[model samples]
Target chain A: MKINTTNYEEYFLLYIDNELSTEQKTAVENFIEANPSYQKEFELLKQTFLTPEHIEFEDKVLLYRLEDMEAKLPSTFKQSLYRNEAKVIEGYFNTTLKRSIASVAAIVILIFGYNLMPTTGKQNIQNQLANNTGLPIIKNESSVSVSANSTQNRIAQNEVPKIAQNNTKPSKTLPSIAAEKADNTPPVVINESIANSAGQHVNNENEMRASPSANNTTVITAVNEKITSNETSIVAEAKEAFENINTDNPDRTIYIANMEIDGDKLRGFTRRIGAFIKRNKTEKEK
Target chain B: MTDKDFNNCVDAYSDGVYRFIVKNLGHEADAQDIVQSAFEKLWVNRAKVETEKAKSYLFTIAYHQMIDHIRKDKRNNTTDNFEEVKSNVNISANGELKQILLKAINELNPTQKSLVLLKDYEGYSYQEIGEIMDLSESQVKVYLHRARLILKEKLVHLEKMRA
Candidate 1:
């Protein structure tokens, strides 16, 4: 704590290096002045401070990575920098062409999905009757032994009377807490099926059509308004286009871009065009 | 760190590092090599190092490389202490205190020289000098104080002999 003859060097070093606080520095100053003999030693210690030399590193260029940093355009990707009217128009046309092709492909897929998907009401009821194991087989006098393959036909003949008479017992009343669990499964929208069957109602017997192999599920029928106006318009356009292209003879082969050709060869030419467009599209993607 | 950050490091700390090395090693080419090696190491490890710590990081690297260079040179060749320096550089009766101080600093061991350089030249605190030289803070203070005393003794000895 005291700066004296013995411990004074450490205090002097701290003072010269500016490590001492103001109070300690003042104390050190007083101590040095009190003993003039130590003043010369402090002065020599102060002289030990090394003056900085200004030596510039000349080849700092070697340390720089000029090749690593390329002048990059900002992230906004300034589209205006690429201004070209003809290219823009070409891009628009290309996008429209791709959309048209996509629309045609979607229509073809929908047609296939529609054909494979929905069950007619009578057919689904027959399937349900054949599948529901809880319902014992009614081998009445009107029927004999039923094989697995003809189970649907046998169910149709026997179950028709019970179902058509509206004698299907209502679903058993479950606990009040779980009363709605009967419909807990997602609602199965039979809108497209009902739409296609016209007058025959697949919506009515939806609950009764649970095949035995199908999981124990309650079918809820709800009308779906999923088709948008754009989709309807695309379908209509596809229909109009289809009708125009499909004709009985060359005279009736609706205008092929105003070029007349044998109707037979038109199919092959269209196929080739489709193949070429598909090939070019895949190449561009790559 | 990005390339831009690394280049900024080179621009900012290269001169300080080069100056420290050259003054201690007393050879421009070897000091340049040591400084270049430090920068190259910083470049490789830029990602792990923060930009805020770049100056200390550079100094730490250059200090060690300079030490290694000195060690290798000591092994391969003989070295001269302050007496040899005094024998060679005779001023007309101790003319320049600056020359005497410079020669005296060069006479210090590598660690002592680095302690003085980081302390006075770079204005580093005792703690910071310790980090650069891998010494403890207390050790840095003791060693640096010892080095300054040696420099002072040299100056006083030379002046007395000449006087």
Candidate 2:
């Protein structure tokens, strides 16, 4: 800056602040020397700069943290609980893994328990099957052949004689059902419910004779149909139970040594959490 | 910063920071409280703070706290009388120029006063003062220069009246 009457103050301020280089400092000094009146202004400005006061913060000791406070403070609550901190904090990951395994096992138990529960509906089905002479053949073809009042399934290699004895007893309506079968018409659906209301058919044309012997034959036929339908329901329920377990070998529903959790959501959650734990462990090790 | 470095900071900078605060506050207890708080912050952030920057960091925290304290307690302590100060400066011996200068400093507002304090008392550069007070370098220079001119007027007035 050209140091003169109008702008000497700026230069003087910068001069005192030591912002000016040697060349600028020399120029300012020469200008001040040339002008005696501005020298007093410069002197008075210099007096404005404050002097340092010697004062001390006496409580410096209060702010000191030379030692780790955590080391000094005993774990009073942990000690009172009579638990080792190391034992509690460590092995927590292993405990979590064990818990996941245990949970999966618990899930397995819950599934089997629910599937195998002897529900009254299923008990009726089992009782019906047991009454018919326990054989897998009856379960294989769930529907009976209504046209001949004969079961549709092949005769069991062992139980054919028992079924033959039951079939030999002729019913009065058997001839009429056989005549419909010979004509290739659909066999009539029978209803012999204890509810007389339900015994009424929506299609009245195919209604059967209501003689007492005909009624007995109708009741027996309806019972077999029920067992047939119920057995189908049991097959479906068993299939659902097997589907819950991971069966790489479809024959095996569950094997403790080769168990694989099937639910995608549960598997993904466990995998992410396991990966997170493994990452943390690796980072800590590093 | 290490524990040794922090202790070293306390020994070295506590006096300078206390002096800076008490001068601004005009109250010993408040200054003591502010100085302690600044050091406490230094201790808490010792890991982040380095030994080289601890002094400026402490002063920065202390200066801000002082400003807040002063704003909260406006002219509450040591309320100055300009007329009384003028009269006293007029009559006082030339030996007491430092005392007269201090009174002149008290006449300035907080920002201007801090500029003067940081510039003259601690010998901080305009850049360093800007960092402490969160001002631009040019702003510090302009504000400080204006404050210095006011002080100069006061001192010059006294000088002319004395003659």
Candidate 3:
């Protein structure tokens, strides 16, 4: 009753589990049915591993329970489908489109109104019209009103006619007046004085009213002086910060020192390391 | 298909797919999420999935999604407390056997594990496993054989331990 290793090992488990193909199954069945010892071994292996005890769910109750549990299990697909459902836009499409068109129209109107500034300076108006229409100012429509107002104001003054007559009388006194004004104005106010030389002496003072920088000159000068002083102190502070920056031995990655080491000092420290090691050896020998 | 048709398919297959996912994933929340994601994919691609093929398609999605979750989670252990195994003594021997079965299943590589599960749990034939896994029938057989051998080995080990 010697069972060959290959046959016993191959068919023993397969025979137990009833997993052999039909022909092989028949062969194993016939063999086991004849031999009680081999049959016992086959049954032991099968019952031990394949018995319902190992897999408790082979019965109808367990199968029914699985069905019941499956029945109770929620449909995840439906939940996901509900979650990803396309959002419904509830209102009428025509209404939404119409509202959007109206909004665009209002934005266009506001942009046009904002560009039509009555009091914008000539240069500012030129820049705005260039920016708005993305066109170079061939003749900026925004500046025409300001120019007309200036011309009308000039006509009302009767000052230009007088200035023309005075121009005929005043070549000798003109330079003297200009020289006196230039000498009296500070370097800080030189730009304002340059603007004042444009029309009549009276007109010169009137044009001075239009100088953009004139009113802010005092405030700008105080700010400039303060900034200059602060700049010198900042340079000094920066120099101190640069000087105080520590450069450790790159290999060591860190160093603690009370005093700062400059580039030259760092080189010196690196060179000293080898000599220092030698010195330590000599001292240890002593 | 209409939303109603889609809903019907969902009703038919959700629980089965969910049970399969729960068994594979072994966690209630992870299984639920994977099941939900699988359904979302079906809903999004409802036009592509037909009613006849809906159950298999749903399971295909759930299986892939479960694998993806497992890959991301990196939890290698496969022994999940039979959330389905409620009362202990009713199937005492069956519980140990089931654990050994799952342990054998868990020892399989992903493709093998999937093939065996589809065959044993879902009752799919070799051709069906091939269709789901995008393998040839011969390839499925090879992997199934390897998986069965591993299961048999584990079963043998369990028997020896019992002895």
| Top DockQ model | 2
- Specify the poorest-scoring 10-residue window by lDDT in model 2 chain A: A194-203
Off by over 4 Å in 3: A1-286, B1-5, B75-95
Give the Cα lDDT of each candidate.
Answer: 0.61, 0.61, 0.50
Each model's backbone clash number: 1, 0, 7
Top candidate (TM-score) = 2
lDDT of 2 by residue, B1-163 (tens): 9888988888888888887777676777777899889988998898899899999999999999998897777656546344553452222234577767877888789899888877877889899999999999999999989998898888888877887
Error of 1 at A173 (Å): 99
CAPRI band for model 3: incorrect
Error of 2 at B106 (Å): 0.5
Per-candidate Cα RMSD to the true structure, in Å, reads: 20.3, 12.3, 27.5
Cα misplacement distance, residue A93 of candidate 3 (Å): 34
DockQ for model 3? 0.07
Q: What TM-score would candidate 1 get against the native?
A: 0.48
> Among all windows of ten consecutive residues in candidate 1 chain B, which has the lowest summed lDDT?
B85-94
lDDT of 1 by residue, B50-137 (tens): 9999899999988888788778888988554345434532223333887778878887888898888887778889888888889999
Full candidate order by lDDT, most accurate first: 2, 1, 3
